[model samples]
Target: MDLKNLFNVNGKVVLVTGGSRGIGEMIATGFVSGGAKVYITSRSADACDKVAKELNARGPGQCVPIPADLQSVDEIKRLVAEISKQDSHLDVLVNNAGANWNGSFHDYPDEAFDKVISLNLKRIFTLSQACLPLLSAKASNANPSSVINIGSIDGIRVPPQDTYAYSASKAGLHHLTRHMAGKLGGDGILVNAIAPGAFQSKMMKATLDAFGDIIKSKIPVRRIGSPEDIAGTCIYLASRAGQYTNGAVITVDGGAAVSANL
Candidate 1:
């Protein structure tokens, strides 16, 4: 095993949920570029198909989009079953599907909290559990398979305003990452998280457009995140290079999280 090749994911199979756009799409693209056979899932079949077609056309690595809504536990099981039918084992799972609704705490209805927690926290747990067997089967001689949970900087710190449910849900997810990693470590299945700061997705773009300069000015890096930044972290965590790392939350926030309060 060459040290540099440890980061190579060639011939591995990766399943990324919510991979039609935003951070998920970027991660799928990165895996495809790195030579992994990638399977992406989303609620919209058309969106998944479109992205899959685009990725498969770009490289030798295959990208198949399997339409499944993470909110549905049965759908997640079915998706995993379908994946198992096609491939005997799975090498990586990136649970990145999530959404948020912004409103003042008093105005934030119960529905908001329910929806955020359902998608962000509950869905991740269900899907990962469904895929555990396959992940264990893929763990091997030299390299161990991995689970990379997508998190956010807001989960680690207060963001100055509302998004309370979303923030709290992600914070729970961060703790879940640690717990799962510990329990799964003995199986050679590594679990970790990537906490990303401002990225150029529809969600962040709206925030940037609304407060672009003010937000950028406050950051130590004087900029928001990019798709490549998140992709790079995912590749590492999923690849053999990161086999020794478990229960770690790698923050890709461009120094924002470390900025001094003073």
Candidate 2:
């Protein structure tokens, strides 16, 4: 077996939720460049289409855009149906679509909690269920299908902000990944989660802009995450190199998880 072939994902079919930008886009780009046919989804049709077009132009593989707001069960079902029409089997599913909210502990609204949980936690479960049949169709003992959940370091430790619901949702997602891996392992499906810390994304831009230097100073690695940091981890999980790595929460933080923040 050639060593480089272990990381190759050529000809695989992959779906990345919220692939219009940020970590999802990074992973989708990696998959496309590595020669995997990728389907990217987001709430904004225009954004999804634009990303698909850009990725396709840069790919040895192809990218198809499917826009759907995955905040409701109906939307997830519709998104799954759309994929079913295009392909019968799915080799990989990346549950990267998520939402976060922040507020003072005294005045945090119920709606905000529900909104974050609905998108971050509930939809991941529903979407994974919807995609299971397709994933299982292409899965086997020798070559298992992959499910990559995007979690956050906030889930693993206390955060500096007041994102209560966001933290809770991601923590739940991490546990859910383990449970799904245990249950699905028999069916030839590998489930894992990537807990990222301080990446440059639309969601984190405001916070990073305000305290990037302070944050970096506290981190042992003395820097935030990058697109390549996420893309590399994603490629590993999706490729042959990570077939046996099941039920794991791989933290892609720059030593933040273990650093002493002062």
Question: TM-scores of the models, in the given order?
Answer: 0.96, 0.98
Alpha-carbon RMSD to native, per candidate? 1.4, 1.0
lDDT of 2 by residue, 76-190 (tens): 8988898899899999999999998889999999999999998999889999999999999979878999999999999999998999999999999999999999999889999
Clashes of each: 0, 0
- Model 1 TM-score is 0.96
The segments of candidate 1 whose C-alpha lies over 4 angstroms from its true place after superposition are none
Strongest candidate by lDDT: 2
